[model samples]
Target: MSSYVEGALVEGERIVHAGRISAWALWHLIGLGIILLPAFGIGLVFLIIAYVRYQSTELAVTTKRVIVKHGFIRRQTVEINLSKVESIQVDQGVLGRMLNFGTLIVAGTGTSHAPLAGIADPMAFRKAFIEAQDEGQEGI
Candidate 1:
């Protein structure tokens, strides 16, 4: 869990599902690094960038809200209450489908959609959100 997500949680909130950027998403950088490693140390920079990107992003469905954060210094965060979430849309390409990683678009009532790219197991994230939403409604 990222510090932002942990800090954003309120009383009684618990994470139901945590999402991550798939290693597959970093293939290009990894490949570039490997290909350039023999030429110079520049390849190390690509690998480091990929590692930083993987570590800096976080996504989760919680009892109260869905949260997503990206970046370490210049941060971007999104939160949508369970009751206000209109939809969770997943977009998968051929490779993504085979690898079980995709993009997630979270739509909240009266709010612009938040698109999270390169998320692993996006369907599971959507399922967790749906279950949480249902449970929250039952408690109301």
Candidate 2:
């Protein structure tokens, strides 16, 4: 769990699902790194970038809301309450379908729409969100 998500949690909130960045999303970087590995180790830079990006991003669905944190130094965070989310859309290409990774677009009540790319198992994330939303509604 990332510090941002841990600290952002309110009373009685618990994470129901935690999403991750799939290595398949960094295929280009990994491929370039491998191809350039013999050229004075320049490939290491690409690999490092991929690693940093994968490590820095955090995605989770909680009992109350959906939380996403991106970036290592400069940060970007998105939070949408379960009651406020209007829809969760998943986009997956052929390769993404094969690898089980895709993008998630979360549309909330009002004017908020968050697009989260390079997410692993986007369908699972959407399913989790829906389940959580249903549970929240039941408690109301």
Candidate 3:
């Protein structure tokens, strides 16, 4: 668990699911050979981006809410209460489906939509979230 998510947790809120972007989803390895070139600035930039994204982004679901955190210095975080969530949409291309990585778009009440890309086992994440939501609602 990242410090960001841990610090964001409220009293009695427990994490139900936690996940990170898969390295394979980045596909930066295909361009790794470009680094050998003298003018490899573009390739290096891609590698840096992929590395940063893979390392910094986190997705989690708690008993109270769903949480997503991304970025390094200027961080971006999204938290949506389970009760407010309207839908969790998953998109996977052929490759993504084969590799088990996809994008998850979470739509909450109003105009809020949080899109988490390259997430590993997005289906499982959605399942956990739905289960948590059911459990939370049952308690009410």
Best by TM-score: 2
Q: List the residue pairs that clash in candidate 3.
A: none
Structural similarity to truth (TM-score) of each candidate: 0.94, 0.95, 0.87
Report model 3's TM-score to 2 decimal places.
0.87
Each model's lDDT: 0.90, 0.93, 0.87
Stretches of candidate 2 off by over 4 Å are none
Candidate 1 wrongly placed segments (more than 4 Å): none
Better of 2 and 3 by TM-score: 2
Candidate 1, residues 50-75: lDDT per residue as tens digits? 89989999998999999999998799
Clashes of 3: 0
Question: Global CA lDDT of candidate 2, please?
Answer: 0.93
- Point out the worst 10-residue segment of candidate 3 by lDDT: 29-38
Evaluate model 2: give its TM-score. 0.95
- Model 3 residue 26 distance off true place after TM-score fit, in angstroms: 1.2
Residue 22 lDDT, candidate 2, scale 0-100: 87
Point out the higher-scoring one by lDDT: 1 or 3: 1
Model 1 residue 25 distance off true place after TM-score fit, in angstroms: 1.2
What total of clashing residue pairs does each candidate reach?
Answer: 0, 0, 0
